[model samples]
Target: MAQNLVLIAGATGQIGASVARHVMDRSGWDLVGLSRRVQQHVPCPMLAVDLLDAEDCRRKLGGMQGVTHVVYAARYDHAGGELESVDINLQMLSNLLTAVKDRPDLRHIHVVHGTKYYGHNAGPGPVPYRENAPRSPRPVFYYAQQDFLIQQQGGQAWDWSISRPHTFCDLVLDEPRSITLLVAIYASMLKELGLPLRFPGTQLAFKSRTQFTWLPMLARSIEWMITDRTCANQAFNVVNGDAERWSALWPAIADYFDMACGDPEPERLARFPESHSDIWCDMVSLHGLRPSELSTVAQWAYGDYVFSPEWDVVSSMDKAREHGLTESIDTRQMWRDSFDFYRSHKIIP
Candidate 1:
């Protein structure tokens, strides 16, 4: 039997890390991960390569033999706005494609996208965004990357797949940009401060429906896309087959921390977490938790985006279900499992 080697880019990131871990646990698959920095707890072989530099990518990735799959989860965040973000992200993908274009054994390439493809990031859009929804008018890198993949696949042996997920939930600890970690840190801080676990956004956001994609679920969807022929050359929305309202779920979250749920306290989370740095420090000492600064653990800007939303962000998972990927998870149970995992790792009290 031939060996299957899967290359996972951005292996330390939320989506990429989950994919790598999932692939590692399976049989008859070899895993190779790429990141700018060396990850400590990853279970696969990792290569330190900067995807932005074309020459560096060629030098490092050109020689990897027998790579059958590529999961492109690498991303570059630019603060200068959409145009700059599009340019840098496009260049990075182009560099990776140019380096790997010659691999004969490559059978599939999967790109990870998000709800921003449907204009959720800019403002409200139609509910339950299907795979065929019209592209957003704003400049986005998802279109560019998909177009690049289509162009590259012309007369080539490899096919491509894309998965769009929303508000990833994973077990990464102390990751500043992870919404789950931010919520956990925020709740822990509130507990230490003797404050109620309040719905810290507008009333609309508290009541508005939202969706999430568990990291492992997204990973499994990617794997199904890679292995299932029916999923080739198609984009699908992969979410936890349910929608939730924070107004109803806030109490469960508050209960997890043994705090009372208070009324909505609409405030910019970007500025909120910083004010409680001293409280976070005191909590770390009181709980005998990991020694790390609050800023390194909580991302207030991301929290604000997750909590202060005015519109519902729900995507249709019917496409994925129709294709025989029937995995689903309960949103509340997913949160409980994640919180337990964090406590087991000593990330929160």
Candidate 2:
């Protein structure tokens, strides 16, 4: 049997880090982590290759040996409240594939995609988004990447799979894009201010049903996709298999922080943190918490986008289940577990 070596792109990110950890803990595989930043803490060889530069990707990745799998989780940098660049995003993936696709040992490629493929970011997508749903007319980078993968893999021995997870719920301390960490930070700030934990978005978002993709579950699902031949060239929506509204979850969250839950009051979270830096610094000192700047701890605009959605955001898990990945998690428990993790890590007091 050939030794399985998997190259994980974006290894410092929430998804890539979790997946790399999963691969590391498992037997019968070796891993290499690629990222633009140097992550000395990751438990594998690291490649500091810029995915945006085709030559850089080639220079660093072109000489790889026995790379049996590729997990493309890297994303191009872009601000919230705008469409991510299709050309640049597509180029990143193209650069990676161009560097590694010639390896005869490569058996599979798995791309970590998201619900945005359904245009949920722009507005409400179809209720309970399915893998078979038509391509969103909106020009999203996800479509460009997927199309490139489909075209590039034609008649090739290496098969491909895509996992579409909704808002990722990650517990990694270093991940700044995490919704779980963002909310924890937000609630802690409100608690320090002696204000009730007010729902920061509109009433529509408070009432709209939403879902989350537990990072660990998504990692396992990606492993299943790569190993299971049946998953070849298919897309699966990987979610917690439960839908929830902020109205129901907000109170529980407030209780965890020992604060009262206030009714929905719309506020632009993107601007909320600008005025709360001193409060966070004070909390860090008083609680002996981990030193993290407020701005770097969370991307407030992402929270604004998440909390302002007026439509239900759900994706069917039946496809993954029918295909033999039967894992499911309780959405409420996921939230509680996330809070517990942040507290354990001293990310919140």
Superposed on all Cα atoms, the candidates' RMSDs to the truth, in angstroms, are 1.8, 1.7
Error of 2 at 46 (Å): 0.6
Residue range 210-290, candidate 2, lDDT tens digits = 898999999999999999999999999999898888898899888888899999999988887688888889999999999
- Candidate 1: worst-modelled 10 consecutive residues by lDDT: 77-86
For model 1, name the residue pairs that clash.
none
lDDT of all the models against the reference? 0.86, 0.89
Worst 10 residues of 2 by lDDT: 170-179
- Residues 263-318, candidate 1: write the lDDT tens digits: 89887777775687788788888888888887667777778778766888899988
Model 1 steric clash total: 0
Top TM-score prediction, candidate number? 2
TM-score of each: 0.95, 0.95
Residue pairs in candidate 2 whose N, alpha carbon or C atoms collide under 3 angstroms: none
